[model samples]
Target: MRVDSRTLPLVPLLLGPVGALQLPLLGGSSSASQAPIAADKPLISSPLLQEQVKAENLMQRARQLYKIAELGEGEYNHPTRVIGSKGHLGTLDYIYSTLTNLGDYYTVSNQSFPAVTGNVFESRLVLGHTVPESATAMSLTPPTKHKEPVYGQLVAVANLGCDASDYPSDLDGAIAFISRGQCPFGTKSELAGKAGAVAAVIYNNEKGDMSGTLGTPSPDHVATFGLSDTDAAPFLEQLHKGEKVDGIAYVDAIVESISTTNIIAQTTGGDPDNCVMLGGHSDSVGEGPGINDDGSGSLTLLELATLLTEFRVNNCVRFAWWAAEEEGLLGSDYYVSVLTAAENKKIRLFMDYDMLASPNFAYQVYNATNALNPVGSEELRDLYVEFYEAHDLNYTFIPFDGRSDYDAFIRNGIPGGGIATGAEGVKTVTEQGMFGGVAGEWYDPCYHQLCDTVANLNLTAWEWNTKLVAHSIATYAKSFDGFPKRVEETSISSFAEEPKYHGPFLRQ
Candidate 1:
C-alpha cells in the first residue's frame, strides 16, 4: 500500500505491550492504548479483548491483503491463494512470520502436504455455432486438444450420472449431459468416460452458474465442465424435440501434484488440556481475490492473535490457517485425520471463521444443535448469540453442513461453532428486512468472481462480525463454565450430504 503521509506500526507494533510503547494503533488516542495491560497480571476478559478489535486495523489489514491479491499470485497469476500459488505461499509465510515474531508467547509450525494443483487456461462449450460464455470447465478435467470445435450428438444422462445403469447403450462418441447432485463430480466424469462419451457437461441446480473441480486428476476421467441451468437450456430443449444437437467441449488446464502448507499457532500460557481452538481457511477459488470469502476471516484471526500476545489466558487459544479448503476442505481434513483418538480429546472446542464479510450481508451463526455436533457446541453457539443480542443485532442460523473447513472438527466429535456473513446463498426477503441489502441477490454478489476485491467488502458488517469472533476467543479462553463433558464417541453422524461445497461455492 502507499506509505504517503500515514506511518502506522506494522503487525508487531499494532498495540505495543498494551501500553508501554503506546502508539496510536488504528488512530486511537494515547489513552486507548494505555488502558490497563501488564505482563504479570492475568489479563483475560471479554470486554478487554473486544476493546482491542478496531475497524481501522481491520481496514488497514484488508487493504494490505487486497493489494497482495490484486498484483496476482503464482506463475499464471490465476491463483487467488489457491493451492500451489505464490499468493497462497505468501499468506502462509505472513502468518508464520507474524506469529513467530511474538517471542515466547506462541508455538508456531508449518505442516506441509502434497495436493493436486491446476490452473485453467480455457474451458468452453460450443453448440452449433454459438458459445455459452458463462460455462466454466471443471477444475482438473482433461484438456481437449481439438484445434477446431468438434461436433458430437448430445445425449442427456439420467439419475445424476452416478450409476453405470444410467447411461444409454447407444450413447457412443457423444457429449453426456448431466445435472449436479447425489455424487462427486469425479465419479460422474469416470462413469461418463466408461460409457463412451467423448466429453461431459454438468449444469447447476441453482439459479447462478458454478465452478467445479474433480478433486484430483484421474486418467480414466473425460473432459468435463460445469454450467448454469440457464446456459444449458437451449441444448436440452433441442434434444427433447427429437432434433440434432451437435456440441464441442474444450478444456485447457495445467494439472500437477505439489506440496502445500497449513499454518498452526497456539498461545503457550494457557492450560493445554482444555485448549480452545479457532481458525479459517486461507485458500481462495482460482477465480478471484477471495478477500471477503476467507481473507476477512483469516485477517480477523491474525489481528486477534497479535492483540492476544499481550494477554494471558486460563485455557490455551490455538489458531490455524487451513490450506486447500477451496478444493474440498483438504487442509483441515488432513489435520484432523492424522490425530489419534487421544490427541483429538485435548481440544475442548473448535470454532471456524469462513466468510465474515459480504456485500449484501446478514449475520449468520452455525447451528450447534445439529445432530452432527458434539455436546458443548451449543453453549459456544449460544455465546455468539449472546454477543449479537447484547448489541441489538439480528442474526440467522446456517446449517452445520460439510461445506466449510469445520467439517473435520465436527466429524471428530469436537465441539464446533462459527459465525459468518455468507457466500453464494441468496438473501431472503426476511434477511432483507433485517440487514437492508437487495433481497434476491447473492449474500456476496461477487462470490467467486473476479470482482471480489477490496471494493467488494461491507466494512461495517466485517467490523461487527470480527468483534464477535474476538468475544468468543476471550470467553472460551477464560473458561468453559456451561460446557458439557465429551463423553460421546466422536460425533452423532458423518457429513453425508450431497454436493459438498468446495470452499464457499457448491462443486458440481
Candidate 2:
C-alpha cells in the first residue's frame, strides 16, 4: 500500500448512500442461472475446493516467490521485487506462464500502462548550521533543483497548508514548511510553489516517521521532502517564537516515466460478462523481498487460480496480479480507468487480498458493512465473515477505503470485498486474546522492511486465509444465487474525485 492508512468518503455514493449497502431485492440473479450449464463440470463446492488447499502447496509457492526475488532478474536487481525491477518482471512472467499452462481454462493477457518509477539517491534536511534532521524525499516527487541544493530561510505555512491562504506572500526563495494533513503532499508542494517557495518540507502529523508519496509529478510541484513529527516539533516551536530558521532542503532522485504491466486472467468456462476479479500486487516496495507485505496474498491467488482449474464455474472468475500498486494502485487504477461502461458492468465484483499472513495474525474482513460500497459488496464481505464464523474463528473488520487494489472497482460502483491478515495496524490486547500474538507490536513488524521474507509468515494464518479466499471465490463462481442483480442507470460515479486522506493516497 502506498499510504499507510487511507480513509476517504463514499464519493457520490453510487453503490449506495454512505453506510447503505442493499439494493432492492429482485428475483434470482441472471448472472448465474442464465449461464450455459455443462453437465461434465460439477458445480463448485466451497468446502471441497477449500479442502484441496494443502499447506504444502501454499508454502511451496511462497518459497517460489521468495526465490524469484533473490534470483536477481530485473534491472535494479536489489533482491527486491519493486516495480520496473527485473524481480517484478520475473514475478509477472511466472504468473503469466502458470495461468497459460492451464490450457483452455483461462485467457490470460498482460496490459501495459505508463507510470512514474524512481529511486531516491540522496535526501537531507539541515537547518541553520545545526545537526541535520532525519528526512526522506517523498516518493515520485522529482529530484530537487535539477540535483542541486537550494538554500533559503525555512518559513512555516499557517495551519496544515491545505489552503492557499496558509502560505505567506513574502516567501520568495524560501523553503515552505508545512504539516501533513487534510491534503496530499503533492497538493502542499504545489501550493508552496505557487507561493514562490523554492521547496516544500512536510512533517508527519502522526507519531511515527513518514512512509509517504507525492503521487505522480505535477508541473506546479516543487521538490518535496518528508520530516518526522518528532523532528518537526522543535523547529515549529522555533518558528513560532519569532525566530529565523534558515534551512537547506536537498533531495536527489531519478524520477522518470516508465511502462509497467498488469496480468489479467479470466476463466473460459463461465459467463464472460459477469466476472469475480481478485488478486494482490505483483510488485513490492523497493526496500525488501516483500514476501509478507503482498507476496503472501499474490501467491495465494496463484494457488487458488491453479486449483480452480479442476472444476467449472457458473459465473466467470477473473484474476489480476496488479503492478505498480505500491506506487499508489496505478495498475488497477489504470485497468478500471480504461474500461468502458459496458466493461464496468461486466465486472460483477472485485475482491482484493493483501497482507494475508501477518506474523501477528488477525483475520480482518474488508469492512464493507461500514463502507458505502456497491449494493452487492456487503454480501461479499458477509461471505468472508461467514467463513470465519463457520470455522468459529475470531475476526475483525477493516475500512474499505481506497487503500488497496479494490479502490478502482468500488469507485465505479462495482461490488468489492476481500480478506487480509493485517498490516502495520497494531494488534489490540483483545485481538491478542483472539489470535495469540504480542499485543503492542505491529501485525507484521517486518511490513515494508527487509525482514518481510518468506520466513516472516505465520503458516496457520496463511493456510486459513487461503481457505477463506478459496471459499469466497468458489461460492460466487458456483452461483450469484441470492445476490442482487445489476440495475441500470447512467450517472457513471467513477473514482475521478475522492475523500481526503487520513493517510497516503494517489491523487487522481
Candidate 3:
C-alpha cells in the first residue's frame, strides 16, 4: 500500500505526538478458541462458510496479535514490529505455534530469507540559535556522528538538487541547503558531497518536514538531514537576503543485513496441483506497531485458517505471512523468484491483504476487470463485488496497480486481486456519502505512526473485511469452476516484465 505523492499535503504534520511508548506483552489467551481435531479422526462433513465468520472472533484474534507486536518493542528503545526484530519474530512464533497445534489439518513451513534492516540510534538538527527541530533519520543513511556541533555557513542551492550543476562552487566548507524533488535524496546528497559540502540539509519541496533515505550509502556522500519547508523557510529567506545562517546537523544510525522468515501454511488435504493463494505482510514499519496496516490482514488469514479447519476443500488453499514487506516487497519477491516454473503454474490466483481496518474506512476492491485485466483478475474482483452487493454494502474500485504483495505474482503473469480499506489517501466527499467518514481526513489518521496500535483499528471495518476474507476463501477453496486453468508450461521469461512500483505511501 504505497502512499501517492500527489495525495500528500505540502505541509505534513510531525509523524506523531512525542511521548514515552510501551510495547504490549505477548502472553495471552485468544478471544476465539476451537478444540484441535484429532489426527486419526475423520474430517467434518460441513463447510463453515460466511455465516461462521464472526467479527468478534476476528477482533479477538487481532487483539491477541497486536499484543505480540507490542512485545517487539523495548529492544530498540522504540515500539515497532519491524522484520528481523524480537517483536516480529514473536509474531512468527505465535502464528507457527497456532497452526502447529491444529495437528494434521495443515502443514506449515517457515521459509527463511535475508533482508537488510536499519535502526536509528540518534537523529537531531539544531538551527537558528540552537533551537532544536523535530526530525527523523532516513533508512539506509550511513552512521554519522558529530561529537560537537560543527558550524558552517549555509549555502542555498539553485533548483532541487537533482544535478551536480545545482551545487555552488564555494560549498567546500558550507552546509548545502537543497530542495527535495526530481531525483533520489541520495542523488542530491551525493552531488552536494562531491562539491565539497560538509553536510547536506534537504528541505521538503512541499509544506511538511521531510524525512527520506539517501537510498544507499556512498563514498561521495556526506551527512544529510530532512527539514520541513516551514522549518527551512526562515533560513532560506535570510540566505536570500545575503545574511549568513549558521547551523549544526547530527545523525547516527546502523544499517545491516538480517535474516527473517516468511510463514507458509497449506491445507494437508487439498489438490496440490491447483492451489488458491492468499497473503499479507507479517512485518511492520519502524514508526510503530502496524496492527491495522497489516496485523489486521495477517491475523485475518490466521483466524480464517483456524476456522477453515472445520471444513474440507476440493482445491488447496495456501496462506503466506510475508516478511520484509516494509522494506519493499522483499519476502514476496524472493519467494516468487525461487519458485520453479512448475511451482508458479500450480497457483490459480493470488489475493493480497495489506490494510483492511482503516478508521475512516471505504470498501475498495482491486479494479482488475475494467482496468488492468490480468488473466483471471476480473473473476476475483467480481467475487468481492458480488459479496459486497449481496450484503447491501456500497463498494468502490482502486486501480490494480502493483503496489502490494500482489505485485510479484502479477509480474509473473499469475492472476491476482485483493481488498484495501484505505491508507494515507484522503476520503473524498463522495466517499463520505457512501462510507460515512470525514471527507477531508485520511482513512487511517495513525497510518505508519506510533498511534497505529490496536486502538487505531476500526472494529466494524475489520470485522466486515475478515468475513469477506472467509467468504472469498470459502468460495474459491470449494472450487475454481469460473477461474482460469493453471498454465502448466508457463515461463517467467515469457511474461512481460513490469517495473516494480513503489508508491510514496508505505510498502509497495
Candidate 4:
C-alpha cells in the first residue's frame, strides 16, 4: 500500500434523470377441460450472443483491449508507458480514451487528488541479538542530509510499536525504543507522536527483516528511522538498566503535489435507477510492469467492460479503472468517500478484480470462515460457491484481511467479491503437484520486483482466469437483485480466529 490512510474524493453524481415505467397484465381467455403443454425455454447453455448483443460487442472491444494490454504487459511502471501514470494522469487518459471512443455510451466524470511520495524502506536486523550488521534500513529510505544527530533517552514500551497510545506523554524529549509485534510501521509512528517521543526506535520481536513505511508525518510532527530490534537491543538494554539512550532519526523532507485519474464507463438501457460498480487499480508498483500484479485485474475489467458495453444489461453497470492501488487503495477509497448519501444508497454492489491472473496458480476466493480472522460474509461465500458449481470450476476461499479495494466498498455496506490468479511467494502445495509448477513457491516470482514483465506472464493462466472474471462479472451485472444473497454478519475478536496455516486454494 503506497499512501497510508489517505483517500481521493468521489466524483459528483452525473447520472441522468430516470424516466417513468409502466407494466400491464394482459387479459386471458378461459381454458377448456383439455390439458395444455407449456413451452420449454432453451437452457442458457452458452453465452447468449443475440440476446447479449452488447456482450458480444463488448467482447469484440475486449479483444482489442486485451491486445493493447498485452503490449503494455511490461510497461506497467514506465512513466511514458501505459501503466506509468498509476497515480492519476494515466488513469484519466485511459478513461478519456474509452469514454471518447464510446461517445454516447455513458457520461464521463473526473475526480482530482493530490499525490504524495515518501521514502519507503525495509529495515533488517541480523540474526544475532546485538549485532549492528543485522540492522539495515529499507532501500527506499530517503537520503539523510548532513544534519546534527538528534538524540534522546530510549524508552521501551509494549504495544507502542505503531498505535498512537504507545508513547508516553512524559517522553517528549526521550527516544522511544519499541517492539515490532503487531500493526504496521506507519501505525507505530502515529502512536509515537501521541507519546511525545522525539524519535522512535523499533526492534524486532522475531527474527526477520521488517518491511513497511514509518508512518507519514502529521502537520504537527515528523517521524523517521524505524530501527530493527537487533540494532536497538544494546541501547534498549542500557535504558532498561536505568541508563540513558540516544540516537538520530534524520529525515530529508520530500513532499510533492500531483494529479491522477479514475477511469469510469457505464452501460446504457438498464434499470438506471440502480447501479453496480466493478473496478481495479490501473497503476503498478514503482518497480516492475504490473502485468500480473494488477494489469491482469485492470485488463480483465477492461475486457468485461467491452463486453458489457454492447449487451443489454438489466441493471446499470459502471466500470471503474482506479489509479494508485499500490498506494493503499487510494483511488478506490477516494471514489467511495466522495459519494453522496443518496448516491451510496443507489449502489447495489462493488466487485473488485485484483491480480486475477498469475502464470499458473490457484484460484482463491475471498470471504470464508477462518479460525483466525472472522470477516467471512456468507452472502459472498454462497455466491462464489454457486458460480464455481455453475461453471464447473474449483476454488478455495480465504478470510478477508482488508488488503484490497473491496475494503472501502464493504465499509459502505456494498456487497463485494472477486477472483485472484495468484502472485509470487504464496503458492500452495497442490498447485505445484498438479500444474508441474514450483511447490512452496511464491504465487508470483516477480511480485513487486523488476522481473514482472510480459515474458513472465502465463498466457494460459491469464486466459482461463480472465474468462472466469468475465463470467462472474457478467452474471452479477445481469442479475444484481438476485445475487450476493444476504448472509449473517459476525464480530471480530482477537487474532486467534484467523487461520495461521495455509492450504490449497482452487484445488480439486
TM-score of each: 0.86, 0.87, 0.78, 0.69
Worst 10 residues of 4 by lDDT: 499-508
Model 4: per-residue Cα lDDT over 403-486, one tens digit each:
677766665555666667666446677666545467777778777665665655666556655665656556655765544432
Candidate 4 TM-score over all chains jointly: 0.69
Off by over 4 Å in 2: 1-39, 73-77, 129-134, 146-148, 163-165, 205-209, 489-497, 500-508
Clashes of each: 1, 2, 10, 43
Compose the digit string of candidate 2's lDDT tens values, residues 1-508.
Answer: 0100111111111112212223321122211122332458767889888999887887888787777776443444456888776567667767765665565576656677887777777777787766435677777777678788889999989998989999998788999999888777788988898899888888888786765678767777888877788988888899999899988877787777878778777887788887888879988888777998799889999989988877888889988988888888888889988888898888888899988889988989888852466778888888887788989999998877778888777767788888888778899999999999999999999988778987899999999999988988888898887886665631236433564431224331
What is the Å distance of residue 499 in model 4 from its true position? Answer: 16
Pairs of colliding residues, candidate 2: 74-86, 74-87
Best by lDDT: 2
Clashing pairs in 3: 2-505, 3-505, 10-207, 10-208, 11-207, 11-208, 12-208, 24-70, 72-87, 209-228
The lDDT ranking, best first, is 2, 1, 3, 4
The number of residue pairs in model 4 that clash at the backbone is: 43
Best candidate according to TM-score? 2
* lDDT (0 to 1) per candidate: 0.76, 0.77, 0.74, 0.52
lDDT of 3 at 455: 84
Candidate 1 similarity to native, TM-score: 0.86
Better of 1 and 4 by TM-score: 1
